[model samples]
Target chain A: ELKVEQNPLFLSMQEGKNYTIYCNYSTTSDRLYWYRQDPGKSLESLFVLLSNGAVKQEGRLMASLDTKARLSTLHITAAVHDLSATYFCAVEMGTASKLTFGTGTRLQVTL
Target chain B: DAGVTQSPTHLIKTRGQQVTLRCSPKSGHDTVSWYQQALGQGPQFIFQYYEEEERQRGNFPDRFSGHQFPNYSSELNVNALLLGDSALYLCASSLYGDYGYTFGSGTRLTVV
Candidate 1:
């Protein structure tokens, strides 16, 4: 069984601060994905890290994957209130694209 | 191009009843996957369908079943529902063998 764990289940940070959410999985998988979900909304794809040392960045967010360590990270740079949401990291084990998701990190950015 | 589409934004059901949720894959996408998300938790994979067949499933019980039409639309059926079944049901679509996915807004199901 593949188990995905994430830390800092809840976070309350002031605007302009920075933080990193960690996702650790128990299996070896090369495809890892990041998603963000707001209250009452579906997930929004953040990044798709397909290889070791893979890193992708969008405004205010950067995600990286280390396949050898079976770990992924979502870094928040200079947070804003609009950035508040629950972020999840998922591991895809096979070609089927079935995703085993982490517990999720809920971030709340305040002024 | 339209993204994934799911029907019945919300539903209410009693224990032991059955519910069916629908989904239409995104344009040019040939795979569909279903997920159940509890409040404040990450979404759990229910199953994935490709080429009109269920290609993979998660750890969900047999009470949860699904089907995909030739047009790439899908339906998720849950029998003998329980209060614990209440959650948001999300549908995601992707191209076969492609890692990129697009998710639907999800159907909120409340089991009483």
Candidate 2:
């Protein structure tokens, strides 16, 4: 069984501060993805890291993957209230593309 | 372009009842996947359908089944529902061999 775990399941930070959410998986996989979900909403894709050293950035968010370590990270830079949401990291299981997701990091950014 | 589409944004069912959820893949997408997200938790894969066949499945039990149409649309059926079955069911679509996926807003199922 593949297990994905995220750290700091709940985070509360002030605006302009920075934080990083860590995702560690139990198995080996080359494809990792970041997704953000607001309360009661669907997930929004943030990044797709396909290689061991792959990194992707979008506005105030950035994500990186390290396949050898079976770990991935999502970094929030200078957080804003709008950035408050639950973030999840998913690893593609096999050729079928099944995703095993982390528990998720709920970020609450306040002013 | 429209992303993944799921019908009946919300539903309420009683224990032991059966429920069916539907999904339509996005344009040019040939594969459909279903996931179940419990409150305060991440989505868990249920299964994936491609070419009108179930190609992959997760740990869900046999009570959970699905069907895919030739047009790439899909349906998820959960029989003898339990209270724990209540959750937001999500549908995702992607092209075959493509790692990218587009998720649907999800159907919130509340089992009483």
Candidate 3:
């Protein structure tokens, strides 16, 4: 069974601070995805890291993947109040279309 | 162009009853995937449909079944629903062999 674990399941940060949410998988995967979900809303795709050492950034969010280490990271740079939401990292096992997701990290950015 | 869309934004069902949910994938997407997400948890893969057939399924039981239409739309049927079945049913669409997916708003199913 492929299992995904995320660290700091709950995060409360001040504005202008930085934090990184880590996702670790038990098995090898070829793709990793980051999504953001607000209360009562659907998920919004944040980043898709397809290869080892692949990094993608948009605005204040950046995501990186390391296949060898079976890990991915979503880094929040200079977080702002509007960045508060639940962040999830999902891993796609080799040749499988399904994704195994981590427990998710709820980020509460305070002003 | 619209992203993935699901029907019956919210539903309420009784235990032992059956329910059907619908989904329309994003334009030009040939694959549709279903996921179950409980409150405060990450979504769990239920199944995936492609080419009007069930190509992949997750750890769900037989009570959870689905069908894909020729137009790439899909329906998810749950029979003999249990209280545990109460959750948000999310439909995601992606092109075959693609690495990214677009998700729908999801149907909030409440089983009484």
Chain A vs native chain A, TM-score per candidate: 0.97, 0.96, 0.96
lDDT of 2 by residue, B39-59 (tens): 999999999999999999899
Cα lDDT tens digits for candidate 2, A8-109: 999999999999999999998868889999999999999989888898899999898888888898989999999999999998866657999999999999
lDDT, candidate 1, B8-52, per-residue tens = 999999999999999999999999999999998889999999998
Clashing pairs counted in every model: 0, 0, 0
DockQ, candidate no. 2: 0.81
lDDT of 3 by residue, B1-112 (tens): 9899999999999999999999999998999999999998999999999998898899999999999999999999999999999999999999997778899999999999
lDDT by residue (A3-111, candidate 1, tens digit) is 9999989999999999999999998986899999999999999998989999999999999998888889999999999999999999988775788899999999999
lDDT of 3: 0.93
Give the 10-residue window scoring lowest on summed lDDT in candidate 3 chain B: B93-102
Candidate 2 lDDT for residue A63 = 92
What's the CA error at residue B109 for candidate 2, in Å?
Answer: 0.4
Q: Give lDDT: candidate 3, residue B38.
A: 95
